[model samples]
Target: MDLRVAAAVSLLLALATTTGAVTFNATNTATGTIGGLRFDVAVGLDYANLVLSNASAFIWSSAFNQTRPADRKPVDAVTLVVAADVSGAAAFTAADVITLSAPYVGNYSGDVRTEVTGVLFHETTHVWQWDGQGHANGGLVEGVADFVRLKAGYAPAHWVKPGQGDRWDQGYDVTARFLDYCDSLKPGFVALLNAKMEDGYTDDFFAGILGKGVQQLWQDYKANYDA
Candidate 1:
């Protein structure tokens, strides 16, 4: 074997090992009807790792613009738990742990697998994204997470179309759509914005990035649709 070929193979293996180093775990705490739906922790863990790896890359490119592990959150493990008593189909994340309502899993009218995958992507974003030291708007935080979900191709059927939001920070799909517009105006807009949010958040972030206030940008976004 050529020395160059051997060195290339060694580099690839090291990269793969590093990428796969993050650990994922899943648990199901539901019983009865919900538990009967067969929560596969093994499969869920595999998918979570895949989504986490991919999301980190996409968000790094789209928001953080850094690929080094040191540039990311220091978390080395993430756990996905299924809970029976949570209200609504809503999911939440705390630190490195994500909890999905088992009720939502059992009651989902469509493909549960795809729905869960999307939920994992959104929740996993919460695990990795910086929060402006808890000073950023909650709407923007959720929107950024959903932005990852949107980029990952897991956007649900009911998401609002582009240029359809009432405000730039209305949050979730609305804010995600608006952020998407902002990114269109300048590539890596989200990445630069997220970097700014690391210390704290300001409305000026919009002006700093695009030379326009968020409100004016929102107006332009809505106007584009009106045209």
Candidate 2:
């Protein structure tokens, strides 16, 4: 018998072949154009489609999809991994994630509709956001994501309160509110901050925007809010 065949026969005959294990790698298949970006979706996957589709829309709307000096591509090839149920919850990692709601057969509308669009606006910001080469503030990271959601016109209705949070970067809705306030003081403030973050992030960048350190700016923000 051939050496390979002999080895296989020995293994099959030994111990009645009781114990064994096998692993599978998921294959991704690309579908139709998603907001002008093509994607190879993972089979039997749910959330990745939702998130990547929304990111495509935001980039197109924001004009990031257009050719620019940055040479950033509208949609980076996405890798989808389903880990735990992330619906109605926050992501703990830097990777972009989405959890599917009931599949809407027709056009997306209403609250859940907006939440899908909004969360991706928030999450995909993580995908593209620069973090001072991994040295950015945690609060600022959360704030920037929420800020993108805010700008996307998908902020939750209850998110209108300007300033009532404990800290400046309380994350999510709270930090979003503070960013809105900062924008009121300086038009294009968030845009400027985002541009700065593209290169680096620090409290000094906040000072460049507000004429003071972020801590002092937070103090002023609180005083104004309290007034």
TM-score of each: 0.85, 0.60
Model 2 ranges with Cα > 4 A deviation: 1-75, 79-110
Clashing pairs in 1: 63-191
Off by over 4 Å in 1: 1-16, 19-21, 35-38, 41-45, 61-63
- Residue 127 displacement in candidate 2 (angstroms): 0.9
What is candidate 2's lDDT per residue for 1-227, written digit by digit as tens? 01122232343323222322111121222222231121122223344454444443443334233223233323334343333333345333344333332222121244443454465567667665556665777887788778777766667777747767888878878787788788878877776676677567677888888788777777787898783
Q: Give the TM-score of candidate 2.
A: 0.60
| Candidate 1 structure quality by residue, lDDT tens digits, 1-227 | 01112232344335535774666677666645453244453235455455555554555444567566667777878787778778765589999998888767766787667777777778888888888889999999999999878876788999999888677788999999888889899988888888788788888999999999999999999998882
Q: Highest TM-score: which candidate?
A: 1
- Predicted structure 1: lDDT: 0.74
Q: How does each model score on lDDT? A: 0.74, 0.53
